[model samples]
Target: MNPRRKKRLLFATVLIGGVAAVASLLLFALNSNLDLFYTPTEVVQGRNDGGAKPDVGQRIRVGGMVVEGSVERDPTSLKIAFQVADTGPAITVLYDGMLPDLFREGQGIVAQGTLVEPGVLEASEVLAKHDENYMPPEVAEAMGKEHKKMEYSEGQSGY
Candidate 1:
């Protein structure tokens, strides 16, 4: 190969490698920054386990059943508060935006926001459960024991 051609090829290879490295770094950073939410049972038992609670301003997503009657919307503002449950305790979620169409009482929901305090989620994104049987995998696992208990109870009742 010509010397000049070899140099050009080397430079092109370096440029491509640098671009790839930058892309990988950006992807890693983004993934680390993104956070997900979980139900009360999940929080108690630690489904998204091992990581410390996010800093006050970091984003997160929380999923659970909306407590039976805990939804309260502001009369004039977009602020809304509700409790997310999973057979154990409930986490209070405060959101300040228009809610999804499927958000309703006694239904499943996933709210994305920041954890302003322990057991309190300040949500910026409120995602209602969209499908008939779509429960987050983490939420399902957290509720597994409770579901089994219900099954046992039903068997005993014979209905």
Candidate 2:
């Protein structure tokens, strides 16, 4: 092969390799930072579905209504615990930080953390709805499905 042709080919190969390497690195970084969102029902069902549950340390977001009368606080510290519930099931969460002012029972919330146990989440962050009519989109979608299921079951009972 001619000298010029050999040099051009080598340059092109190096350029392509560098691009691929950078792309792979970016994807790896994003994958590590990405947190998947699951409803409280989904989290519970996932644990009981007779399949492998999520890895204990994998980060995830759980969204649902804060179960009424489930909020407990440690007066000596910023620690708080609560349960988030959908129509399917509930998951207890432990958090050690100041909660958003809107956080309360019977309100929609999204907790980001990892599942430390089958039905427990160790939350690193807690987000609450901004207003009476506002809810996280994931929570809304999950609750909508729950509502439909309830309606269907009620309709079937008459038969």
Best by TM-score: 2
Residue 26, model 1, lDDT: 100
If scored against the real structure, what TM-score would every candidate get? 0.68, 0.86
- Top model by lDDT, which number? 2
RMSD of each: 4.0, 5.1
lDDT of each: 0.78, 0.87
In terms of lDDT, the poorest run of 10 residues in model 2 is: 146-155
User: Candidate 1: which stretches are off by over 4 Å?
Assistant: 1-20, 42-51, 148-159
* Per-residue lDDT of model 1, residues 65-108, tens digit only: 89988999899998999999878778899988889888898887
Clashes of each: 2, 0
Tens digit per residue, CA lDDT, model 2, 58-124: 8999999898999999999999999999777789999999899999898889999988987899999
